[model samples]
Structure formats: structure tokens, C-alpha cells
Target chain A: MTKESKKDGGVNPRDEAKERLENFALKVLESVNQIEPPKISIPSRSTSNIVFDEKERYYTISGKTVTRTSANMRQVKKFAQTMCAADFCKDLIESKKTATLREMYYISEGWETGGFADQGRSDRIVEDLESTFGVKREDLGLLPEEDGASIFGDIVIDEGGMEVKATKVGRAGYTIPPTMSDVEFVECGADCVLAVETMGMYHRLIQEEAWKKFDALVVALKGQPARATRRFLKRANKELDLPVYLFTDGDPFGFHIAMVVISGSAQLAYINHELAVPEAQFIGVTASDIENYDLPTDKLRESDVQRLKQLLKDPRYSDDIWQSEIKKMLNLNKKAEQQAFSKYGLEYVVDKYLPEKLT
Target chain B: MTKESKKDGGVNPRDEAKERLENFALKVLESVNQIEPPKISIPSRSTSNIVFDEKERYYTISGKTVTRTSANMRQVKKFAQTMCAADFCKDLIESKKTATLREMYYISEGWETGGFADQGRSDRIVEDLESTFGVKREDLGLLPEEDGASIFGDIVIDEGGMEVKATKVGRAGYTIPPTMSDVEFVECGADCVLAVETMGMYHRLIQEEAWKKFDALVVALKGQPARATRRFLKRANKELDLPVYLFTDGDPFGFHIAMVVISGSAQLAYINHELAVPEAQFIGVTASDIENYDLPTDKLRESDVQRLKQLLKDPRYSDDIWQSEIKKMLNLNKKAEQQAFSKYGLEYVVDKYLPEKLT
Candidate 1:
């Protein structure tokens, strides 16, 4: 046989064995697919504990019970593993690169929590994704929270609505996903569901069950939203029946967030018309309130004023009354916080928004 | 043999040798000190042909120049090295503290030209100084030219007469001490001598050759008696016959300089009250100039203002018109530099002071 077919004991022996094993595994996979596939018995929850109820099917994957008809525990594990492996696999396929099989296996398992268990590792992975695939934390709904909970699942609110926040936690956790049950729940019907967001407000919202239920959801977008957040908000309004009201501090970051939500082009993303939500209104902690409330001048930072003035140059936001109010705040060099409204106590908010109060 | 006297070649030989060297060095230093006796030599112009003559008087210790006169530079360098031993030294010291040992040395050498050489090294030294000492650059002043040239000489100009600046540079080639000549010339009844000041100003004036052709000689007295800058003015009035006038800046430094000339202080070796001169009047750049000329705000730093105000509160200086005027300048944050009267190039100053023909 030619050198290709020869399996002599030399430097090429190990390489030949590895190729043989890979080809054998591929053949086995093909045969496994072809052979009458084993019927995966998905566990079903019956109305009565007796006869089989074929109509409503249930299954468990890595201990989580899911109701989706096509779900199988083994299949989900496989899918999770596949998704995890996809990071490396895609990298390999696109770049003609390859990593150890063990690395691929661990990466697949890592996708169960979207790799957030080890924060440092998750952040690194997200960064790699962003740099390599142009994927944003907001796009993956993996953005950070300002306060409370290590992940979106841990964010629990009582009767008082949830506060979603994002700082510089991770790239994945900044933008909120619209597909989250909470976002859908808020979007569906709940009135006065305030989304007290910090930096990563949108990213966390899209992962919750309450996002769909709100009649009027207050979105406190901190700095600005990425393209994904804007896109989600646009899709959310179009597909769901909720109106988004934005509230931010009377500073550059706050002003920019409102502008992003309403008109949609911020520093990085240029999805202006595609992502802009025309109905979203700027609300609360206005520049006019700073003087009217007799706020302390020292509370205002000159850098903050300088930043706000920079945003006023953007034509998309320049004409906005809120932008003008922000400019006035800068000129006066005074700042007032949202809690400052409580200086007048609950009475002030009631008096100001009494007629329009949902409750 | 005793340990002190033994020349041991044993285990401790190195220590013994070191001890011997130390003792020898100490003895040599002591002998050198006895021989030199720490004499303060006033350098003659011919000391060094290549190097400039003026800087020769700066004190040296063991052949090394006393690089700094104040604790400021020492402190700054110490702090900078302690904080962060990075390249920050250059930026911190240079921009923060403009003058360094080399620049000071150059200044002492009569290189009166502005701008610093070896800016990088100077900057590093200043940064090191600031970092170590916490002294800001603005607090220091270069030694005045006249003071540096004279071996401690003083000059005084009387009110309502021609302005005369007596400096050593004017007597560059003169050999006989001006002090003796002035005493002899005044006693002989010179016709053109305008004033007969105390030994101090008279010495400097004669050195400058200004005493040769003046009008009357006014001899200033301490407490209205026989002597000072005022004695010279009175003598000039009697012998050479000329009207007298005075000029000074708008600050405490200038005020005190004038006072020293008119009233002989005990510290100046003119202790007799008989030598006090009471007739001299104050001239322009008074405290009122602060309000009269709408000067820069906060010219007198807040601390300085507070100190001056405290001084004004004192019973001694409070009611004094001159002191109160100084306080007014501090309050209004206005200052008058002699340069402001001319070099500031204000059209009002030119039109008001200079003749129309010159304009």
C-alpha cells in the first residue's frame, strides 16, 4: 500500500491511529442515526396517576422539568453540550483550528448556566465572543445586575416591582432579552411594573417571567442601551402590548439612556430607525427638578455636566425637551436624585402623578 | 595586646582595618577644618576668568555647593521617591516646581536671562521635591538682582524728586568703597548732591555713582534727628537744593522697605532714635488701588487675605491708613506690580503717565 495506507511503527503511527478512531466514530454516528433510533421515553405528568396521558408530555433535563414536546433529558444534555462545544467548534470550523476533545466536552457542560458559575471565566468567555463573533452581552441576555442576585434567576421581587441594573459586570449581561418570561409577563398586562435598571437593566429583564405582564413598565436605563436592548424594546412593543417609560438621573449617562431608548443610536450601535421606539417617553429626575427642589450644588460633578452637554449635539436628541432640561442642569451645575423626590415625601409623587396612577 | 592597639590578621582583621580608615578620615577632616577656619570669602571679579563672577559667593561645604537654601526642595524630592518611584517624578516635579538647584545656581551666576535649561532634569528634581516635601512651586522667589550684587546694600529714593536706582552694576569698575567717598563728599559741601542717606543707601548710591551730580542733599533722621535715607534727602535739600519724592509698590514688602530707609531699625546697626526720619511721605500704589483698578479676583489667596485681615484687627495696624489700605487690597483681591504701572501696557497708564509726544 501507499504511504497513506501504511501503518508502520514510527512518528506517523499515532497520527494514523487518531485518524482511524475519528473515522470509525463518524461511521458509528452515521450508523447510529440510520438504525431505527431508540425511542426516548420522555416522562409525562398525568392528571390521574394511572393511564398514560399522551396529550401533555413532560421531560427532565439535568434535573429541570420541561414541558416542551420535543424535549428529552439526554437530548437536552446533548444540546447543552453541543451549544457549549459550539463555541470551540465554530471557532475551529471558521478558522480551521482545533482544541482538545476534553476542552470541547467541558465547554459544552459549561453552557448550562451560560458559563456564569465562575464569573471570571464567564467574563473572559463573553469577551472572547464579543471580540471574535461580534456578539454583545445584551444580545445573549448575559448582562450584569447592579444589585441583588449573582444571576438573573436569583432576582426576586415582592409586591414591589423588580429593579434591573447593569454596571461593568460582564459584556453578556448588559442588554436584556425580550424572550424572558418576566419581560413577556410584564409586556402582556401588569400595570405599574417599574423596572429599576442600573447599567444592565435590559439584559436582566429579558430573562425574567414578569417582563410580559406590565401595562406600563418603567425602564430606568442607566447609561445607554446597546443595539440588542434597543432591538428587543422595539420588537417588544411591536409583538407585545406594553408601553415603555424611561427614567434616569439628570446626568449624561441617564440622558443618553433615555435618548437611546427613544431614538436608538448610541456610541457603538447604529441601529437608529430599526431599533428606535417612538412611543417611549422620557420620565423622572429631570434637570428642572434640581433647582425647583433646592438641591445642593456640590452634588453635581462638572464632568457629569460636560458629558451631558456632549449628548446635546446629537441631532436625534438635541431638539428633545428633556435634552434641553439636561443642558440647563449642567449650566446650573446642580444634580437631584430620584430619591430626592421623596424629600417632599410620598405626597409629592402622589400629587404629581395622582390622576395617572395605575394603582 | 589590647584589641584597640593590635594589628590583628585574625578573623576580625577586616573590622580593624575599617576602624583605622574611619579614624584617619575623621582626623584629616578635623585638620582641614582647622586650616580653613570656615572663612566666608567675598569673591573678587578676577577669581575665575571663564566662569561668571557674580555666583562665586554661594557657600560650599567640602568643595560641594550647598545646592539648596530652603527645606522645600529636600522635602519635595523625598516625598516623590516615597510615593511612587515611577517616571512620575519628571511630570510631578518639573511642572509642579519650575526652579531647581541648577537653575538657582545659574541665577546666582548672574545669568539673569529667563527660561530654565535642562528642563527635563529640572522637572524631575521639582517633582521629587514636591512629592517629598508637599511644597508648591509658587511659594519661592528668585533672589533680587540688586540684593545679589551688593554685599548687603540698601538704596532709598525720596518723595517728589527724580527717580534714582542705585545698583552695584553701575559701579562695576570702581575700586574705592563708595561708603567712605560719600561720607567725605557730603562733609565737603558738594553742590549737586541730592541726598545724604545712612551708610547703607549712601554706600550703595555712591557705589552706583549717583551721588556725583545731584541737587541738594537731604539727611534722613531716625525719630526726627540726625540720620538714614531721609537724612540724605534733607542734606541734599540743604546743600544741593532739590525737592524730594518717594515711590513704592502696593504691598507690605514695599512698605517695609520704605520704612527701613526712613526709620533706622536697631537690627540694621542704626539703633539711635536720633537717626529716625519722620518727614518722608507715602506715594502711589496704595491699598485703594485694589478698588480703583478692578484687578483680578482672588489675587491675594484666601489664606493671605485671612492673615491680613487678622493683622488689620490688631490694634497696631487696624487704624493705620496705610495698613487699612493694604487690607483693602487683600479684601478686593487686587495687587499692583510696578510693572503694572508701565509694562502691563495699558493705554490708560501710558496716556495718563507719559507725555503726549512719546505716545
Candidate 2:
């Protein structure tokens, strides 16, 4: 929808989330006191409700809603969980803290009757809360536990209050945090952001100082871009005026990861406006690269072939570039990793392939 | 077993590795040219060859050897692969570059008959080379593709020639590189290092600035410690004289990971001296923690119980503390995660649990 704000004409996302949760809890409390049904309405997050917002260049939810009420036994446990989770988020914001999704699941164990039996059930509630409140889970001080991705090169960021230069960090670069809300881009000397899908390729690029050659900041997505990684790239792409290029393997899964980073995943469509980098480009290890670079490749597995066929119908991959690439990959019956470029030599990807693709 | 060195009264691990490879290659060439069978003798790395080196406080190989020769059809491929891998490594060293194990495996795809059918075959060759040459794969310019692990707190490391202050970095801290040989400990402000098993707990500690509270450098192990993470911990412990305490989930798998950091795993027994930190201690989320903190727990799965049974017989976990802990967990039939402490509050792990355990 729109950026969160406060009554005093200032933007405070955390405060906004806290206030939303408080207001929601108040409504339920008042309903209970009046001997009326306590219920929460959340947007339907089913696949049928997902739509490719061509104007926004990302997946988003349609205007369909589902209501959960304490009145129905089948929906009561979920209803109670939703209320309890809202309370938990409020407590986190009040304490100026956050909880990982996994931690939140475990923390629920202490709740009298609102505890979650599994993480998947707890995760769905967080998603429901996000859509119900029109805010990100990140805004609600609920973070998903993410893999350690990394960023390197000529960029400065204000973490909490301290300014840190990515260039001045460790050899492996700066660790991409679980949340990027507290991080503000202070400065950038890069022309673009190169997001590599594999850590091996990313490390090779860093070791070869490819960032300097391209005058770009490099980030390792570490497979499918983690939410924090996508947000980091989005901010870097937007705030720093840097174009984003996603470099991944020559497979359906890799192409899908690039699509997720560029246009947002259907599953997480609710946060597309905040997380998606619609301008992001997918640069190589595409099916064409296998032929052009004569890269080493593995025969596509049965699952890979199936994924490619499915992606052919996915709206996110409808663009000519993606469609052509996916079709070519299926035809070739081959998949190559980012590391497959090393068949040319260890420096080939950094010294040759990347320069060719980016330039 | 002594430090790698150049003949010119200087220590240069890379150069030393290069020389060893060159010499080995020369011997092989001589054998082939003279029409003799080209053979390489490698230290046996099987379980029977592993021993608990009590003085070293780690697992190491015993005085046993195995031979691979081009004389046999089965060994011929391995023999050729070894020769080609050495040549590949020499090229990397000469070019002042490195290949990730995955890349090396892929690179071999161009080596005609020397190409590996799978990554497993290639990985074993690298390990064989390591034990054969008495040098780490890192020294040979063969790097393992590792998960991104972070290091935070008051410590300075010389990455290549540039110095990095981990505390002055981003919110997630310094990203620990795949190889730590090039990283020199420059300075330290912390008294000890806290190696965390999970990123979620690590993030919680960072959010709360637990390092400041305990005067410790906090490192996220990101599950069963990657080789790079273990090396980073070892170097930090040994070079900075910082005591290391591993904080992990109170489960059989978690305990085993902690043990791997303290006493090297049997599989990589060859690199124990370089990678293992014998003095490292498990700081809890122990079986004791389940009772001590009234932490939330899950019933030990059949798998967890089996793993505990295995660890009970593992030499690394033979001590009274481990034996007692493993038995207690079995008796309780329960396991807990580092995040289980979040049942109290998001900051419980950092503000309370760690401070209590670390102190």
C-alpha cells in the first residue's frame, strides 16, 4: 500500500507496526467485552489469490479476504495464535527487540494454549499478520532466520549508528545481516550491484577483485536470495542508484531465484513493494552461456526438467529473455553451476565471463 | 608437522605447497618417462587409521599408508586425476589464484579421462592430495565452498595486506573467509571468543551487543562448523590467545559440532593442527541448560537419540562433562535449541543465558 507513518507526520515503521498491533488487540478485546465475536480478517494468500501486478512489475495479492474468528472451533486455535502472535510482536517492539521466526515458534511453547505445534503453522500466521496489517514481518519486528550472505566493495552503510565501509571489511566481505531496516546506505562509489547466486563464484570474484574492475558492489545471494538479501539489493539498487544484475547457474532453479529477486516470489507477494528490485537484470549462466562459454554442465535431472516446464507458465518468467532461456535450457537437457565457468580456469569467471556479461 | 616454509629462510605456505607439487610432478614425470609405474603413497585416512592424539587434543592419522598406482585399471583413473589436480593447483598458485573445491571438480570436467563422474570422487582426490603431501588443501590453493559465517566484536585481522576491525564493520560483522591462512590476527580487545552454532542466536547476541557484555568476540558457526569457520576460530584462539567457548543447541548434533571445533573430526584428521582449537569449551545449551533455564524443548527424535548414542562412544566426547550431558539428554528424551532461551524473551540468550554461561 503506502509507507507507514505516525500521527505527528513522521515515518516510524516500528512504531507504526506497534500501533497497528495495539489497535487490532483493542478491537478484539472490546469485541470480547461486548460478548461479540472476536475475529481477524486476513487477505487470502492462496495461489489463486496471487496476481502478477504488471504495473508494479511484481507478484501481489488480489482483493480477496478470509476471516478467522474465535467462534468456530476449527478456526479458534489459529485465531488465538494470531492474537497471541500480535501480542508477542507488540512486546518485542515495546522492548526495542525482535524475534526470529524459529525463535517465535519456540517462544510460543510458553503460551498457555496458543503454542504452535510446528514452524510452518507459526510462519503462516506471521504472513497472515503481515497481510492483515499491511506491513512487512520485518516491520513487525519478526525476522526469518536467514543464511549468512555477504556484500563486498565500495559502499558505506550506517548500521544502527556506526558507519562501516564494505571495502574496509574482512577478506570475505561484510556479512549481510538478518535485517536491513536498521542499515542506511551512507555512500556508494559503485555503478551497479552484482548479486552472485553461489558463494563459490562470489568468493572467486572477490579474490580476483572483480568489483574493482566493474566498479560495482558484489553480494553473494547464497542460493535463492534470502529476504534480507533481496531487501539489501533493493535498497542498494534504489537508494544508491545502482543497477542490479543477478548472476546464477544455468538451470530452472537459478533462473527462478533471479526472477524472485527481480519481480518477487508469489509466495512472498505481500512484501513485494518493499523487497522486490524490479529493475534487477539476470546476467548469465543462462542456457546460452553454456554454449557461448563452452562451460561444463551436468545433464538436467528429472526434477530440473519438470521445474523448467513449470517455469514456462510462471508469469515472472514470461519475458522474452526468461522464456527463451528456460526453453533453451529444457531443449539442451543440461544444467551448469556458476562454478562451471572454472572449466576455463579459476579466474575465467572473474577475469573473462563477468566482464563480458556486465560490460 | 612443522610450519611450512620456503628454502630461503622465510615462511611462505603457498610457495611451499607449490614446490611440493612441482617436486611430486617431476618424480611422476621421471617415473613415466622411465617406463616405471607412477605411484603415490598417501597416509591412510580410514577410521582404523584415526587415533586420539591426547597430547595434541585432536584426532589424527596413525602411521599407516596406502598406495595408488597407474599400474591397475581402477587406480589408473585416480592416479591420473591426482596428477591433473596437482597440475591444476600449480597453475592456480602460479597465477596467484585459488579454486573452490566445487570449481576444481567442475574444472576437471575438461580433463578428458581425468574428469570425475561426480563431486564426491573429486572431493576424495583433494583429501587424498592433502594427506599425501602433508599440506592442507588451502595451502595447495584448493578452497572449500563454505557457508557465510560472521565475526563480531573487538578484533583486528590482517586480510591480505589490509587490516580490518571486526567491531567497526556492518551490523552482521566481518564475513569469515574460506581460507584463514592469509588472515593474520593484528589486534584484539576481547578476552575470549564465543562460537555460536546457529545464526539466529548469533544475530540475537549481536542485536544485544553481547560481545560488549562478556568481552568476547562472537562468531556464528552456522550449523556444523564449516572448515573455514573452524579455521577462523582456531587462528583467533591460538594467535590472539583468546579462549574460545562454543555455544550450541542442547542436542546430540549440537554437542558433536562443538566437539568438532574443540577436537578435529576424524574425516579431516590431517588438518587438525591447523583447524582444531583444543582449548575451546562448550559454553552450554547443554542438557543441563534444559533444566537450569527451564527452556522449551522437543522430544528427542529417533535420529537425535541415535546420534547421542554414537557421540557417547566418540573419543572427542569421552570426557566426564560430555558423557554426563549425553546421558542426561537420553534420560530426559528431550533436546533444545539455542533459541529455546527466547521463550523467556528475545534478548534472554544474549542478555542472560550467554552472560551466565560464558562468565
TM-score of each: 0.27, 0.91
The candidate scoring highest on lDDT is: 2
Query: What's model 2's lDDT at B251?
Result: 86
What candidate 2 keeps of the native contacts, as a fraction, is 0.88
Where does model 2 sit among the CAPRI classes?
A: medium
* Docking quality level of the chain pair in candidate 1: incorrect
The sequence of per-residue lDDT tens digits that candidate 2 reaches over residues B210-322 is: 88888888898988888878877876676566799988888877888888999988888877888899999888687888998888888999999888999888777888988
True contacts kept of each: 0.00, 0.88
List model 2 lDDT by residue over A112-159, tens digit each: 665787899999999999998987787788887777468888877776
List candidate 1 stretches off by more than 4 Å. A1-187, A191-215, A218-232, A265-267, A270-278, A292-299, A320-323, A353-359, B1-359
lDDT of 2: 0.82
lDDT (Cα, 0-100) at B6 in candidate 2: 15
- Maximum-DockQ candidate: 2
Residues A222-312 of candidate 1 have per-residue lDDT tens digits of: 3455443555456445554345566555566666666666654432231134456667656646667676665322356778856776767
